[model samples]
Target: MKDTDESIELSKRMIQTGELCGKTTTAFITRMDHPIGNAVGNWLEVLECINVMKSGKGPKDLVNLCLVQAAQMLIQCGAVPSGTLKEGIIMARENLSNGKAYGKFREMVVSQGGDLRCIDKPEDYPRAQFKADVIATSKGFISDINALEIGHIGVMIGAGRNCSEDAIDATAGIWFHRKVGDRVEASDAIATVYTEREETLNSAADSVFQAFSFSEVPVEPEPLITNFVTKDGVSNFSMSIFED
Candidate 1:
């Protein structure tokens, strides 16, 4: 068989094995084409997630995107009522707003022997002393943010590791001041990168600039949820899935 055919057959075999083992496999898809948020290090990422939950304000696109994927997965797995998906989202939003999500996150952190105090004071977390801003060159709305590029920038800046032995700065990361649909002016600071080393910060800043794009006209809001799929078939249950 050809290389592509062999590869396809191997994947099918793996899927069959998974099904035989009574394990359900579902794919959740979304694009973070831009940086996920302000945090990068493992601990710092957790802290950022906690802050998101506490503030009840997350990247609206990111949260809704994940929920739409998850709800579809649940329906595929026969885990919950299709009509309850909206309720699930409302519950999730409320949980985050009421700090329940943050509390749960803290419990997980403490259980794992991580320092919990940093959650309250992100500044207490070690920070990359050097920083720089990425300025927009044109006036327009941010049309796209590339996730992979941002991740690459993080690795270049010491926020992530290139090799298994490489060290990651827990506090190093890029922060975005702008999101999709937000208007930006020329020379406006769109994002900031933090790094322990000056050289690394410069490299990261360059990557950040390359990762962003702007258009004169605003881009249509991308649906947080795309198409929901089940064993039976695909469903266009975007808003309905959330109507609890």
Candidate 2:
């Protein structure tokens, strides 16, 4: 919501439309400077989410972002009292750990005619024929992993569509070992990319390597959630309750 004028206008219009129908509307505005979690493709991202839901363990940033969004949703929907945002977060974490979240996901997959065998045992899923590691050239702290560049690389590796007619490869995607602000030694595997096309492997790996920027000094990671937008106004921090 904070990115562009068009998005801001659209958000305001959405809230206004909801108001006309006597509904409440709000949005959690998060930064998109880098990929949310380690995985950035269809199957790889699903596996990451499954691991998080099943074990309540995954990337710290991804977990926190999900919890915060879930808490806000609970508050807005009145499933929990507006003032109990922290409680909502705790409840979400409990659901993740207690298998309820994974259960729901499994149910949804079955209902949608998706094959549960692959999700249940991800190892059985077909592997990418080609794989390459993006190694660090110098020892330093990672200052940036440009999200735009990474997204382009995703398309190049067939993880995403280049055009409306382009087909996606479920096994093609990237797994990051080191993200922003992580220290790396020379020749360390910062990330690994996978794809079915052997010819595209080297170019994709080179692009992924170029997407990373390094600094000799430590870099502060940017905040994931930057603002909260509602019918009332925008705020820098998320609020537990919004007075109507």
Candidate 3:
């Protein structure tokens, strides 16, 4: 869910709906000022997730967010003591680091008839015919990234479907090198756009470049997880909990 007033209210209503259906529900609202992780698209995202689950590492924001959500689930399921979010987070991280999480995912994939080849050897997956980089035009800190615009660019590049019947190019996607609050120099590769269709590569790259905004000074990004909503109530996440 979005970290907006309307979304907050909607989350409460959603929780109530889940209660009426006799289900436990927890809603986590986060900022969409930028895309969640570095890679954007179908296949690229799958690859990223596979890597994260296998190695217990990825972009900091992505890994941290996943661990937090997992911790919340553990709490709800009685896997950890109540109100001990930190302990739940530690348990989740241990499982991830020890390969148990990926093992379970593999087991489910095989039992459920998913393609074992994708998870076993993702390197065999094909790449797009065309790839181009979005270069930084000026030296500065990345102030903002318009995620909605980035999503539109993804659709334009064939990474996503415009209509239900439109075909999707699994290889088409964007891999961001620099995210918000990161510093960049002129001509640095900010992101790379890929597409099977050469015709859409340039246009997608241009749109990707325009989606990023720079600032002369360092910029602080919005918190990823803003509020947590449950049957009990809503509470803002303490920023201190995330501080190193």
Candidate 4:
């Protein structure tokens, strides 16, 4: 993407251009201002992914993201007709709902020499010894969640580490109970923290709470996917258009 802000006129030159369509089927997906879903730890993220693959229902944002991107890819490859992304999305959803995607995940795990027990049972992974809820103090709308700060809180609680050599607890992380745009009552459970260390739980939970910013105004979240690109063209995603 190019921007228009050149004040001083320099020598203009025509650089070589590359092909974007019909040569190879390529695409990219952009996550707009949010993490894929609310899970901030390894186990929680994997569980969400697994659930989506198996049942086609995890996080709405994530589900739409996967289907829309997959639709574009299918369009690029001539696997689906132009201007018929809904068909492609349905095909993608059927793959998940019918267990094709979930079966593929199992095959991948076995091929990678990872434990296959995690396929059906998330409990096979490392689990937190204890869990606690992060309660909301106000009755208001969830205006924003600082994802970067949440990542830091995860690291602080041993979910992640500062460096490659630093050990990470796979089970330590925060699972959000109230997502962005959700309404919260006073004392509502906004999030849940899972960790092995009891002494560090309060600090970690406190950090999670601080990461949330409440507002009086109700938030209508922007779509996770804004547009789709393929060999055909750029198609801006609109739920209203899709519905009609």
Give per-model CA RMSD. Answer: 4.7, 3.4, 1.5, 5.5
lDDT of 2 by residue, 1-244 (tens): 3364556668778888988899888876677888989999998999999889888888978988898888777787777754576878877778888999899999999999999997789888888989999999899999999999999999999999978999999999999999899999999999999999899999999999999999999998877776677899877764332221
Give me the overall lDDT of model 4: 0.74
lDDT of 3 at 218: 92
Q: After superposition, how far is residue 65 of candidate 1 from its true place, in Å?
A: 3.7
Scored against the true structure, residue 21 in model 2 reaches a CA lDDT of: 92
State TM-scores per candidate. Answer: 0.77, 0.91, 0.95, 0.80
Residue 154 in model 1: shift from native, Å?
Answer: 1.5
Q: 1 or 2: which has the higher lDDT?
A: 2
Deviation (Å) of 2 in candidate 1: 22
| Winner by TM-score | 3
- Checking candidate 4 for backbone clashes, the offending pairs are none
For 1-244, candidate 1 gives per-residue lDDT tens digits of 2243453445456556666788754332233444555555565566667667778776766566555554545555666555466655665666667887778878988999987787767767676688899999889988888777777787887778889999877767777888767799999998888878787777778888888878889786555434433333344435444444
TM-score of 3: 0.95
**Candidate 1 total steric clashes:** 8
Quote the lDDT for 56 in model 2: 81
Residue 105 Cα positional deviation in candidate 3, in Å, after optimal superposition: 1.1
RMSD of 2: 3.4
Better of 1 and 3 by lDDT: 3
Backbone Cα, N, C clashes tallied per candidate: 8, 0, 0, 0
Model 1 off-target regions past 4 Å? 1-19, 23-25, 38-44, 66-83, 224-244
